[model samples]
Target: MRAFKGFRKDLTCLGFQFREDKINRTEEANCVKNGFHCAENPLDCFHYYSDWRNSVYYEVDAGGDLDEDAVDSKISCTEMRLIRRLSLEQMLFEAAVYMVEHPKRQWNYGVKKETGTACNGYGVVRGKNPRAAGEKGDFLLILKEEQNSPEIEEIALINIDGKRWHPHKFYDAYGK
Candidate 1:
């Protein structure tokens, strides 16, 4: 979450320009609240914030079980795929909407190539599911600590697609 705080500041530091007479303070505030900033040079801020967010998200989900359910065992592989597709669609729609709303602050799609590279190289790499080995086996120590403990009820799944899935942590009655 500290990374989120940094992202917000980076976004604000980037600043935003408006075509209207007055800048929208509310919009900027909303961005800050949502772990983003209102950048005058959105393209630059977009790259900065996106890179930062991607890294943080990767670190958070580096060691969780991606196959687990939120509350019940109803999340099958098929259902999970559907949910992932839907979530991706929603994210794309939101990005499109943002671009449309802020035409003056043109959005750049160039970062797509390097989107997950930072996270992959430094955060979490693919085909390397940390949970598969053991909680403490991954490069991320914090993730191991959280997963090894029975008290941690929630786990974050950082998939290759750059999305987060919060799955419930289930254990035996004796708290195994």
Candidate 2:
């Protein structure tokens, strides 16, 4: 069995955006059939990873009435998604550091949060909303050589989301 390496906690927040060049026809079809208008060119589909190592530690030193009815709950998952996106971007920045240090490596590897882990099936909380927004989750991932690279003959992405392991390639628009 190949060794599965874990991603740095700091790079957990690399926001994942669907490659804009690729259009998911199935998603588009569903939206049209349901009469639900979605943001055109929706690219926020991939699961984002974050780097938790650089996260600022906040010490909870005070305790107050934590009643659910006391505070007006107006948080939405959309806002949470925005925050998560930003964290993921920051994590990507941290990943650059690693890539620069390890020039010989072909790709960065890391794990993403699994859906069946904890609350809401999310992994760990990478950030928080001041007004009680959605919670963030964590997972694992690592950068590996691109499958079928000239330097490294064949590489594959073992997708855990599915039952069987399959090989994937970095495809651009027009299936390049």
Candidate 3:
């Protein structure tokens, strides 16, 4: 799939605060690792990295057939960019949990349960049986061409909520 090149500059994250002490060597190194120069303004730090398409391609469940045991699937670059933007924006604004849908029948993302007008109905509840259409995993993002390693796995598994669920466990349980 082609990489998403455009990032909506207007979609700046609002109300983000940076810690003064956290801006030390480790933070600077992380900034460099994420492809940015550490700026004096904390807003610059947030703005620079806020673009979802900056350094990684987010992995999604992309719900598959019930007969087979897989939900991981590829999404279009456009959909990826939008989902990233939405996730970051929602994370910053509402601080709520968000889940991205696998691209089986369609591509979309939503918050688990939201009272805010903007975040309502971003997700659906599951029945006794798990379905790809309703699979909502953590807001995991993977680096492009990331080699297999524990470090890579840890980095890819980003927690989007207080509670966490691995997509694989669902398939493993139901596939049996």
Candidate 4:
């Protein structure tokens, strides 16, 4: 079955180095150990690995005995072939496509669940991040990729909050 797997930037998962040129196999899959683990949905890979900037994803064809979860798309199998490594854009595209079929469980990268507004997100290396010089990263998932608008400011990454963040240094009434 077609599946998605996350790996360190070096192509290692757990401690094993997987080769893209060949089919990889292991002992029969057992929960968190003994097999190659993957997910049916691309975004579900994030629940297991979140270093989006430094990690990589692959389209794998998992064969042989498989153990699948009843609820989510988690799966483990003894055989897998790394079909291809996905680029950042490809990862987004795959996730977006999968989310169309499973809309309710999409990853809330930057949007707030209750308010449906932009929220804090993971930081990125400015030069390596796809966002423009001052543009936001995760906010792009929503419609908030507004450039230099007064809404986004020059605050450091960690201090960015939904409220009281401004290009100016003074605190507004909200004390954020």
Candidate 5:
């Protein structure tokens, strides 16, 4: 089965180190003891490893005997082959879409802000929000604001040079 797996930034999962494009297998397939685990959706990975900054996710194929979660898409298998790693944008976009589709689960997502705006490349990206018709670029994302309070974690946009900035800093620099 094709699945999404979460691992440490160093590519370690369940105390085992894995390399890209390599197949790793265990002699046993016990979900509670010795088995490989993955989720069908990338977001479900947060359930296992919540530290986004330090965790990396990959696309993989899981074989052998499997145990599936009744509540979610998590699966435990004896064999796993890493397909490739996923990009941060791909992961964050999933969270973004989840934030929009499940507004009631906003607190769980932890990114949408309670204001009207477009997240830019300057504050978040180091450039202004794209304003031209059908203009596409590297980082600007337009999201409908979720009305709430000051508790939601603002999404940070990183510049090409590697500095991370938040939208509030953008407004502060340019006067919102």
Candidate 6:
């Protein structure tokens, strides 16, 4: 059996808009002024994946001790389909509205070191409103937690590549 690796935290990506004039302000302050900061440096937003699916062609390479003639005999190809995941775009629009309506709204990551483990997550907050295509007014904010930190109390495994594995088990048997 392979050695068991503990839970790996998700890579957090934040997306938000920024103003042309206020680009010099600190990210935390901008997030706070725009009502995206839930508390302090932690952004007050959620990242969601879109349901739209996209397809792409993938090539596989069989690396082994094969002769030159044998290696050129066959072709390996596959199709991979992925959902158009939502990260910052939607969050920016929503956060902008949220800040407008609730200027004092506190958006903060709820994870704490005292919670017995390290909680990893990604978030995006809007720093400004949207403008014309060529105009630069909106901002895309991103935040990422460290990988392989501590374990959270309740962990939900995400099926990113279409294969499902036991959350608590070593996946050495996969792709066999």
The candidate maximizing lDDT is 4
Model 6 Cα shift for residue 42 (angstroms): 15
Q: Per-residue lDDT for 1-176 in model 5, tens only?
A: 97788899999986898877667888766655678988765667776876656888887899988987565567889889998787656665554454445544424322223222332321111112212111123333333332352222233332222234333232321222
1-176 per-residue lDDT for model 2 (tens digits) = 00011123332222323221232121111221221112211111111112234332111111111111111111111111111222333333334333334435432222121111222211211111100111233221222333343121211212223223212322121112
In angstroms, how far off is 68's CA in candidate 5? 0.7
- Report the alpha-carbon TM-score of model 3 versus the true structure: 0.17
- Model 3 over residues 79-130: C-alpha lDDT tens digits? 1112232244333222211112111122122211111111221222222222
Better of 1 and 3 by TM-score: 1
Steric clash pairs (candidate 1) = 15-39, 15-40, 16-39, 16-40
Candidate 1 global CA lDDT score: 0.23
- State every prediction's TM-score relative to the real structure: 0.20, 0.18, 0.17, 0.62, 0.54, 0.19
Descending-TM-score candidate ranking: 4, 5, 1, 6, 2, 3
Query: Pick by TM-score: which candidate is best?
Result: 4
Error of 5 at 107 (Å): 13
List all candidate RMSDs to the true structure. 18.8, 20.8, 17.7, 10.4, 9.0, 23.7
96-136: candidate 4 lDDT, tens digit per residue: 45544444453434322212222223222111112211113
Clash count for candidate 6 is 20
In model 5, state the lDDT of residue 92. Answer: 50
lDDT of each: 0.23, 0.21, 0.23, 0.57, 0.55, 0.22
Worst 10 residues of 6 by lDDT: 1-10
lDDT by residue for model 6 (33-112), tens: 22122211112222122211221111112121212112111211121111122233433333334334444344334222
**lDDT of model 4 at residue 88?**
52
Give me the runs in candidate 6 sitting further than 4 Å from their true place.
1-88, 110-139, 142-176
lDDT preference between candidates 2 and 4, better one: 4
